[model samples]
Target: MTEIPAVENAITIRDLVVDYGTRRILDGINLDIPAGQIMVIMGGSGAGKSTLLRCILGLKKPTSGSINILGTEVNGVRARDMHALRKQMGVAFQGGALFSSMSVAENIQLPLREHTRLDETTIEIMTRIKLDMVNMLPHEHLMPAELSGGMTKRTALARAIIMDPKLLFFDEPSSGLDPSTSAELDELIIMLKNSMRMTIIVITHELDSVFKIADHIAVIGEGRILETGTPEQIRASTNLEVQDLLHRKARETVVDADAHLRRLVGEEE
Candidate 1:
């Protein structure tokens, strides 16, 4: 019999916890995001999805447990080392989060300028390369305020990849967009994973996007990870929380006669 090879993990979190005042936002999250794959974190509002990402990025301190990225322990890592760790990550926030005052090229060049000793000409070339990667080469001169929502998101993506970071984080990539635009972003995300070989962690509640792009999913509910698996595994999971989330149906409901009649008749026909 042949044995299958184990996959390498890029980000690992064990027994992670985050508390704000008296409330615990993330009770205990244990997740292993595989290298070079896109992992989607899904949950309802206030489920601590964003909190987990912040902790991993070292923006928030974890109350307990451990987080390791690219084989380095994040907790108590020195300031200089943490800065280096941060350079390995690029984040696209819920909004485009681009600088309104800077043109697209300038925004994308910010990381390169701050992190690298590359010459101005080299930085300019790299900026163009990143913009091209996100299919925003023609909009390099546009300000964030001037671009449409989808264009803004793509420009933000260009900035995120400007440094060629090993890991990328996206917060609510499809939020506040029409369905078609959101779908296009999903395709772009898939392209990034396939072409760049970067590890990606996306915090999202959009089910369509999740199914379309997630190589694996971690489902959080009430401050804990309820389940983690591939999309098919998640769909077939018998876990009550996972089932409720995937179906988006309340446990029980009493409908009015007219609505119930319409639903039943429509189903029968």
Candidate 2:
């Protein structure tokens, strides 16, 4: 019998919590994203999905708990250390956050220009390579406003990978696209995972894209992680919330008529 090697996680989060004033946005999140795999985090609106992403990306300071990315503790990490760690991470924002002033080629090369002292010729070559990878080489000279939504997303993805990051994060990758376009993007994501061997974390609520691209799925609800497993496991989940999410069923709410009337009348319980 052969022993299987233990899986290595690119990102490990434990008891992650985030708060805003007196309200808690995330509660006790514990997740391990395996290296070189695609992990999709899905949830209904206001379910703390975005909050978790922000915490992992070091944008939000968690009120408590720990986040380790690429073996460096993100929580309370030194500024210089976090800066270095960021060089190995890439993020594609929800809106394809491209600068309207820059051409596609220039946008893709921005990271190299900012971080490296490589010569112009090398930067141009790298930019071309990344653009080619995402099939946007022809549109390199086009402006952000001149491109279609799908093109804009591809350009953003090209920019994200130009530095060959070890970790890639996509926020709502399939948002605002037609089914055909979304499917194409899904294929591109899988290709990147296989070719680059990078750990990819995708935050989305689109079920089609989630099932198509995820190697693992983590479902979040009400500021907590409800479940995490493979797509099949998620589909077969017995959790009512998970089932409701899958089937687009609304969660049941038992409203107390007297309490509702009291609240409407500004009366205390």
Which candidate ranks first by lDDT, i.e. highest? Answer: 2
The TM-score, computed over Cα atoms with residue i paired to residue i, of candidate 1 is 0.91
Candidate 1 structure quality by residue, lDDT tens digits, 1-269: 89998989999999998889999999988999999999999998888898898899999999998999999999999999999999989999888888899999999999999899999999999999888877799989988888988888888888888888899998888887888889988998898899888999999988889999999999999899999999999989999888988777232223477766788889634
Candidate 1 deviant stretches above 4 angstroms: 249-269
Shift in Å, residue 99, candidate 1:
1.2
Question: What TM-score do all the candidates reach, one by one?
Answer: 0.91, 0.91
- Name the lDDT of candidate 2: 0.91
Q: Total clashes, candidate 2?
A: 0
Cα deviation in Å at residue 162, candidate 2? 0.7
Question: What root-mean-square deviation over C-alphas does model 1 reach?
Answer: 3.9
| Superposed model 2: Cα runs more than 4 Å off | 249-269
Residues 149-210, model 2: lDDT tens digits: 88988999999998999999999988889879889899999999999989999999988889
Q: Give lDDT: candidate 1, residue 161.
A: 87
- Candidate 2's TM-score reads 0.91
